[model samples]
Target: MDDMKKLLEEIEKLKKEIEELKGEKEKKEFMESEKIIEVIDKIEEIVKKGFSVIEGAVIGSLEGIKRSLQEKENGR
Candidate 1:
């Protein structure tokens, strides 16, 4: 009878420990996912800014070319 009681106590202790471990794992995973999302958001912002700069440069170049062609025709 004493052995059975001891066995039950041990099982209860083990269950609590397992529950703690599972809680810690879930917390860690949530933290890691948050960091990953932050990094992805930063990357997206940088990409959008880079494309905007490229677009501006392309438009400026086209405008310059058009002006130069108009001046040449005026000269002729």
Candidate 2:
């Protein structure tokens, strides 16, 4: 009977340890996902900035062309 009691206690302790390990695993996974989200956000910002720079360059080029045309007309 004493041996049976000891066995039961050991089993309960193991069960608790298993539960703790599961909790740790979940926390690790959540942290990894958050990191991935942060990386994606950074990439999105970089893409937006790249587009803005390209748009500015295009607008600047158009304005330069317009000025050149006006100068030629005035010269004539």
Candidate 3:
């Protein structure tokens, strides 16, 4: 009966340790996920700004070319 009691105590201690480790793992995973989401949001913002700049440049270039062509035709 003494031996059985000792074994039960050991098992309970192990179960508590396992629970603590599981909680730590969950916290770590949540932090990593939050970091990933932050990075993704930043990347999306940068991409949107880059695309807007590119579109503006293209439109300005096209307008300049059209104006030049018109001036040349008028001269001819």
Candidate 4:
């Protein structure tokens, strides 16, 4: 039964090694997910700011055109 005992020990060792690898893989996946979330948040912020700037520019352009037309009508 000595051969059977040795085989069992080898199997246990392999199981432990497999468990460690699984843990490492999970940790790596978690880190990658966190990085993706961070990048998405940054993109959202940039899009929001970009839209605000565009809206402001559009409003300013409209006001300038209105003023120009008013001045022309008044013969100024």
Number of backbone-clashing residue pairs for each candidate, in the order shown: 0, 0, 0, 0
26, model 3: CA deviation in Å? 1.5
The reply for model 1, stretches above 4 Å from the true place, is: none
* Local accuracy of candidate 1 as per-residue lDDT tens digits, 11-46: 999999999999999999999999999999999999
lDDT of 4 at 20: 100
**What TM-score would you give candidate 4 relative to the actual structure?**
0.82
lDDT of 2 by residue, 41-64 (tens): 999999999999999999999999
Q: Which candidate is the best by TM-score?
A: 1
Candidate 3 residue-wise lDDT, 1-76, digit = tens: 9999999999999999999999999999999999999999999999999999999999999999999999999999
Error of 2 at 26 (Å): 0.6
TM-score of each: 0.87, 0.83, 0.81, 0.82
The order by descending TM-score is 1, 2, 4, 3
Tell me the tens digit of each residue's lDDT in model 4 across 24-74: 999999999999999999999999999999999999999999999999999
For candidate 1, give the lDDT. Answer: 1.00
Reference-based TM-score, model 3: 0.81
